[model samples]
Target: MSDHPMALIYGGTPHRFPMLLVDSVEELSEGLGRALKQVSANEVLLERFGDAPPTLPSCLLVDALGQVAILLLRERDGGAASVWYLGGIEAMTFHTAIPAGSVLRMEARVLKRWRTTARIEVKAWIGAVPVADGFMVLSQRGSGSNE
Candidate 1:
């Protein structure tokens, strides 16, 4: 909540629908932020594999973290003309399964930043339990079109 408009934030993002993992941004400032993702049984991924347990995919946790990282970067740069891409992930660790109906809280911080790339550390939790943590690299490239 850095006083930036939600409409602008959403418009800056490239993801849509099932790919937009971030449900809401809770906190945003400088190079740090927190975001939320509510896991529900109706999610598209849950229905992709018939009879699959209603567990939130761990990969989605990473995706959510990446999305939040982009939000932070975008806010800091005032929606710069760039496209954020998931360039790398490292030291990813999962501690528990995110069951349906759980509200996941993710925290991310920019550990390092360069002209075209940012290294971030992210952690996820459900209530009081830690679920996942990792480091990710986001590459910022010139936008091909107005973002």
Candidate 2:
């Protein structure tokens, strides 16, 4: 287990290495959070491109944002044991290709929350350049679920 505070918070989620996109949590508060992901040349997804300049796929970029949103949810719920799912995405836009050597800064804010579901607005950037923005719906299954 890692000693980093963010790693401890991440322990509440089901994500693991490789699939765990958020590298660090820089800030967190009610309904808001910010995180970072260091894009590296050795990223497993970049392997498919071989000799081409390494660029993170758009899907992964969205996944990164989702992970950040999850962090906010986990913090808000006080590390409750619950399973979260990405229920939907809305109006997402990709502004540019993210190169491997760059760091991705992700921000998520809870737009609304009701019962077991939440609508979060997420955005990603490489330096000052906007890379992606969208809204994601996340649904939580309480620990009481039989599954």
Candidate 3:
């Protein structure tokens, strides 16, 4: 791990631009966290819904949840030049269309970790109702086709 120390920065730098869903990193421990994602009207574009009315995509919700897992993982490990992909996404369900402008709370828990892969459980909710839930698989960047 070189000079790397155990640390966590709540939603910093590149994470804040473009596809930032989790807003405040309220709490993070042992690669587990409860974060918030404030959705703007811009993020809830009509085009994303296609023929459907304006709403957040299930994939985007998954993306947000996955990013949180990535952030937590990188914090425990260290920043990597390579990118990670959604090696697999399963058991995902969308209960309601996340409103364009609303703060959605998300949670991610690291289930397991190995030499080159990690599995994390993810979930999102707009208040008491569940918005989305899934698992994400992350890997090193250049080591895969991602680069």
Residues 29-145, model 3: lDDT tens digits: 787977787777766332454466557776778778887777777656545544455688767777788877768899889888876677889988888888888778776554333
Cα lDDT tens digits, model 2, 10-34, are 6756788878888888887899999
- Each candidate's lDDT (Cα)? 0.83, 0.85, 0.68
C-alpha root-mean-square deviation, candidate 2: 2.6
lDDT of 1 by residue, 1-118 (tens): 3445456457557887868888887888888989888898778675244765688877778888898898888777777767789999999999998888899999989999987789
Clashing pairs in 1: 1-28
Model 2 clash pairs are: none
Candidate 1 Cα lDDT to native: 0.83
Q: What's the true lDDT of residue 80 in model 2?
A: 73
- Candidate 1: residue 116 lDDT (0-100): 79
Ranking by lDDT: 2, 1, 3
Query: Could you tell me the lDDT of residue 127 within candidate 1?
Result: 98
Worst 10 residues of 2 by lDDT: 1-10
Single out the weakest 10-residue window by summed lDDT for candidate 1: 1-10
lDDT score for residue 105 of model 3: 90
TM-score for each predicted model, relative to the true structure: 0.87, 0.90, 0.74
C-alpha lDDT of candidate 3 relative to the true structure: 0.68
